[model samples]
Target chain A: TQLLEQSPQFLSIQEGENLTVYCNSSSVFSSLQWYRQEPGEGPVLLVTVVTGGEVKKLKRLTFQFGDARKDSSLHITAAQPGDTGLYLCALGGNEKLTFGTGTRLTIIP
Target chain B: DVKVTQSSRYLVKRTGEKVFLECVQDMDHENMFWYRQDPGLGLRLIYFSYDVKMKEKGDIPEGYSVSREKKERFSLILESASTNQTSMYLCASWGQNNYGYTFGSGTRLTVV
Candidate 1:
């Protein structure tokens, strides 16, 4: 089975600070997606990257797909309290998508 | 926009009782998926259906079964609910070629 390992399982940061979370895997995927979820809710898709070395920006968040298609990263610039949530990365292949362990982020006000 | 709707936000059931979780999608997506989310395990796929009357077992499908008799609705059934089945259940759907999934609000099932 293919697995995606995420770094810094938990992150605590102050507002306005910049933070980055990484997702790495040994298996290559056709596409990758990033999602942010709040308590009691399902994850909301933040962005989807299909090309290797592609970068997509959504407001204050930047998502980058690694050149090898086996890794990805999410960076938050000037984080805010609203950004505190569970961040997850998912890989899609063969009509199935697998999710990463996830990174729980807390932005202290 | 794609909308995936789950039947329940929270449910409590006794052990050995039969439980059913319902999910519906409005986008007419060809693929629908059911997953259970745990604290540290992230989201583990329980079952998925590619088309009407078609279902496939995912990574973890030991105690779960799914029914997708129609394109827009999918149901997850627990033959006999157990304490270990308590978790947040999520439903998602997308087109055949698209990998981006639109998820429902999720159902938190507690088996006591």
Candidate 2:
């Protein structure tokens, strides 16, 4: 089974601060997706990176797929209160997805 | 926008009862998936179907069964509800082009 591990399981930061979360795995993936979930709701996909060393930006959030396709990262620039939610990284291979433990982020005002 | 709808947002069931969770997607997606979300375990795939009447077991398929008789609908059946089955259940659907999946609001099941 392919396992994805996320760093800083819980993050608390002030508004306007920049924060980065890491997702690492030993096995390579064909593609990777990032999702943000609000409380009591299912996750919403933020971005998907299919190429190694690919970077995608969605407004204030940036996602990067590692060169080896075995890791990824999400960075939030000038986070706001609305950015407070659970961030999850999922690795895809053979049409199946392996999700990370998730990072619960809180952007305090 | 693609829409995924779950039958219930919250459900309470007793142990040994037969439970059924229904999910529907309006996007005409070819792939549908069922997963359970726990506090620390993240999302564990229970079952997925690529086409009508075609099913495959996911990472955690024990104690759960799924039926996909139509392209737009999928159902999850719990033969005998147990306390360990109490968790948030999520349904998702995606197309064959490897696009991002659209998820439902999820159903929170509580077994006593």
lDDT of 1 by residue, A1-109 (tens): 8889999999999999999999998788888889999988899989899999999999999999999999999999999999999999998764678899899999999
Instruction: Categorize the docking of model 1.
Output: medium
Model 1 chain B: lowest-lDDT 10 consecutive positions: B93-102
- Per residue, candidate 1 scores C-alpha lDDT tens digits across B1-112 of 6689999999999999999999999998989899999989999999999899999999999999999989999999999999999999999998866558889999999999
lDDT of 1 at B35: 92
Estimate the Cα RMSD of every predicted model relative to the unseen true structure: 1.2, 1.0
Docking class of 2: medium
Candidate 2 lDDT by residue in tens digits, A1-109: 7889998999999999999999998888889899999998989989889999999999999999999999999999999999999999988853568889899999999
Best by DockQ: 1
Kindly report which residue stretches of model 1 are placed more than 4 angstroms away from their true locations once superposed: B97-99
| Chain B TM-scores across candidates | 0.96, 0.97
For each candidate, the DockQ is 0.75, 0.70
Using all chains and alpha carbons, the TM-scores for the candidates as numbered come to 0.97, 0.97
